[model samples]
Target: SADETLAHLQAALKRRRRLSDQAQMLVRKAMAYIHSHYTHPLTRQDIAHYVGMSEDYLTHCFRQELGTTPVEYLNRYRVLQARHLLAESDKSITNIALEVGFSSSSYFSRVFRKEVGQSPEEYRRLKQSSVR
Candidate 1:
């Protein structure tokens, strides 16, 4: 009876490890897809389809592996690029927002503020002042 219980536990552990590995691989593929398509307007469904899984499953993998949702990850990447363009180029805030894949400057501002503790305009000004 004890031997049977031990064998069952081992099999369950092996199955869990295999599933974890599979989920990690899926997350990696999803990240790659995000990287390549971050500049385009995308949805969770699109990412899920790209990774050959359901939307819920993809979201779970992202959360489990990266501690973030796919949308947050994409938004962060866009914001990172926007910060660079904001600091280095003379592009208008709206143009920079569009270039960074946000559908509207207003949404971009909200997301940027949430992540950076400031608006995009304020960030650009700060960077400029620091450089000067």
Candidate 2:
């Protein structure tokens, strides 16, 4: 009886592992879609539709895989792009913000500061000065 119970547990564990792997793949697909479209206006609903999952389930899967919401991921991606633009381009902060899909310069600055520990202008100055 103990051996039978152990076999049942092993089978259940294997099924769970397989399902977890599938869920992880779906989350990765969602992430890939987000990365490709990060410069566009996107919402969780849109991501959910693209991933063919309900919004709640998508959120659960994303959080399970990435430990952050999709919106947070998108915002972080935008901030990263803004950082690159800040360091390499002479574009104004507002333009960079818009280019990176932030709705407003102020919002972009706020998010950038929250994510990067500096305003875009300060970041640019620091990075540019280091190059010379």
Candidate 3:
């Protein structure tokens, strides 16, 4: 009785661990797609298709593994690319925004400020001053 119950619990645990690993693999695939394509316009449907999962499942796995939505992750990735350009390039903020897949400079600035705590121009100036 007790022994049988213990065996069942162990088997369930093993199955859960296996499923967790599989889910993590799917999330990694999704992330790879995002990293490669973050410079283009993308949607959750696109990511789901690339990862061979339904959109809702992809979203669930991504959030479970990464603790953020796919769109937020994409925005953060773009912001990081923008940061690199700001520090090293002479491109205007608008050009950099568009270069990084942002449809509008204002939206890019808004996301940048939310993520980096500074406007793009201010960030660039601060970075430049620190380097010099």
For lDDT, candidate 1 versus 2, the one ahead is: 1
Model 3 Cα lDDT, one tens digit per residue, 16-107: 35347777777777777877898899999999998888988887876665657878878888898899999999999999999999999999
Best model number under TM-score:
1
> Which regions of candidate 2 fall more than 4 Å away from where they truly are?
1-19
lDDT of 2: 0.81
Q: Candidate 1 has which clashing residue pairs, if any?
A: none
Clash count list over all predictions:
0, 0, 0
Distance from true position, residue 63, model 1, in Å? 0.8
TM-score of 2: 0.83
lDDT of candidate 1 over 14-93, digit per residue (tens): 54453477777777777778778877898999999998999988887777656679899789878988998999999999
Ten residues in sequence with the least summed lDDT for candidate 2 = 1-10
How accurate locally is residue 13 in candidate 1, as Cα lDDT from 0 to 100? Answer: 50
Candidate 2 local lDDT, 1-132, one digit each (tens) = 234234433544454343476776676677778778878889999999998989999888766655578898789878877888999999999999999998999999999999999999999999999999
- CA lDDT, candidate 1, residue 47: 92
* Candidate 3: regions farther than 4 A off: 1-19
Estimate every model's Cα lDDT from 0 to 1. 0.82, 0.81, 0.82
Clashing pairs in 2: none
Q: Which residue pairs clash within candidate 3? A: none
